[model samples]
Target: MHRTLLLLVVGVSLAFGVDWFLGEFIEEYVVRIINLCGIAIILAVSLNVINGLCGQFSLGHAGFMAIGAYVSAYFTTTLRVLNTETGETVVRAPLFDGAWGFVPALLIGGMAAAAAGLVVGVPTLRLKGDYLAIATLGFGEIVIIMLTNFESVGAARGLPGLPNYASSFWILTFAWICVVSSVFLQRSTFGRALVAIRENELAAEVMGIRVARLKVMAFIYGAFFAGLAGGLLGHLLRTISPSTFGFMKSIEVVVMLVLGGLGSLTGAIVGAIVLTVLPEALRDVEQQAKLPGIRMVVYALVLILLMIFRPQGIFGQRELSLKLLRRLLPGGRK
Candidate 1:
């Protein structure tokens, strides 16, 4: 326990130190991509709890993310007043003001998404595989459509001028918390029960596991984190539209999960990092090759090759650890 605590302290210190360095020296464009990567990691790992560990396929992450983004953004941007002398817009929030408001706004957004998850999950989680995926996909579309038409939240136009409260420090902190919590959840009895349900639902039920309840809980859990990621994204981007959380966004998250390796937290992190960085890295190649849409082609080819050569993904069901590293080394397996 002492060692674990020491490691945690070291990890946190290192993360904060990195965040400070990035803020002080790194360019905004690079920092933005890093922030997006952190958000992707949160989304991927959270979805892993449902799709990977629980063996349920869901595709409505965008819906939950939208809920969190809009709710939190709205909460923080409730009242806006014009400064007569300076002609600057001043924000006055009912609950809290300025940067401090982000804390409660994010929580409120997460809770709202969790509530939506419960409403959707209880009935839908009973369905299996493609059926569940379709249901969740439909739910995500419904959310986008509703937001697109809802005028209060700016409808299709989106909300703009949001305060940029999602610094690298906060983003990294939340990302770390989500990763650690997921690891613990994976080792718990609840996680085991979910795994059983994933492997064989009927057998798990016969063994006295409440499969339906667990499935719904897992869905809610995933939605909550997705919401948190959404909040961070909104703050980082300082603008959000209904179209931002469309069907493609959810598909992107799923692709990251699949690419990383199902049922592995480390895989989720790796997948998120790779996918987030890959597109930007490909931009130069596309520009030099005089191909505007080459990145999409590259993405397709990568997935195809991955499916053919390593269907289980880069990590499969395993994780990256000192033991695994040692075993993978030459002449180290004994």
Candidate 2:
């Protein structure tokens, strides 16, 4: 409960802060970008569970996102059910109106993704390291390909008729949920077991940790959040395409984890926010000038520098809890 309260307070406060300081910019465009950042945080932190904590290298997150996006899109798209009265459609968006429609769709999307994760993880979790990565990468590619072939989902065309409902409020709420859940999991005995497995699977097996189960659970949980993020993003954008959830998207989330520092929740959130917003900040250049892929080039430089100097990452496996600061500051604690 304390953790939940903290999450609520912090997330709400941050939302208000952004609203205040960024009121102008946000009114124009930053609002949507901030929402995207929140979703990115969800993806990064969730991926951190599978990659940073469990030491798994699965890369099929985009596939899971595509699955969830299509499922959720089906629920709230105008293209679904229509009213017979005057031939006007009874449109129900996934919360573009700040109503109750968005929440349930997002949860359902997360569940569907989680179910998919279980299916995939059950078979693939047995693999480890680079093999796991390759398998997941293939999974993502397969999902994209499958999306292209599905006629009901618009096939090669983009999925549409979605209501734009994503907002900073919803975005921050999801971010807080991801952060708090991650922190809770990390502090639990199960978290300890996961860490043990990550450190040494052979030793953890001897120590009675169900390595496969833990690994599968991590993958499922990671995919669940990934889907939730995708649903939110799709609704916000009011459209979906297989291309949106692709290998590069998965790589972007992983890069967020790496740049923020693996094994650190704070770092993951920071990395996601920075990366999510940075590209948008450069959008002006793209519109009025020629800045093709400049974001990637600058990002590559920063990554190279970070690898050379602080390969351990920004937090270096250390959490950003206030307790650490309080301890270091002598009288900083309440």
Question: Per-residue alpha-carbon lDDT of model 1 for 171-196, expressed as tens digits?
Answer: 88789878888998999999999999
Can you list the residue pairs that collide in candidate 1?
none
Off by over 4 Å in 1: 1-12, 78-95
Write model 2 residue lDDT over 63-169, tens digit each, in one string: 88888787877776756434556766554543333447777878888999999899888998668788989988998999899889876667878788677666676
Give the TM-score comparing model 1 with the true structure, all chains together. 0.92
Cα TM-score per model: 0.92, 0.85
lDDT of 1 at 52: 95
Least accurate stretch of 10 residues (summed lDDT) in model 1?
A: 75-84
Candidate 2 error regions (>4 Å): 1-25, 80-98, 284-291, 323-334
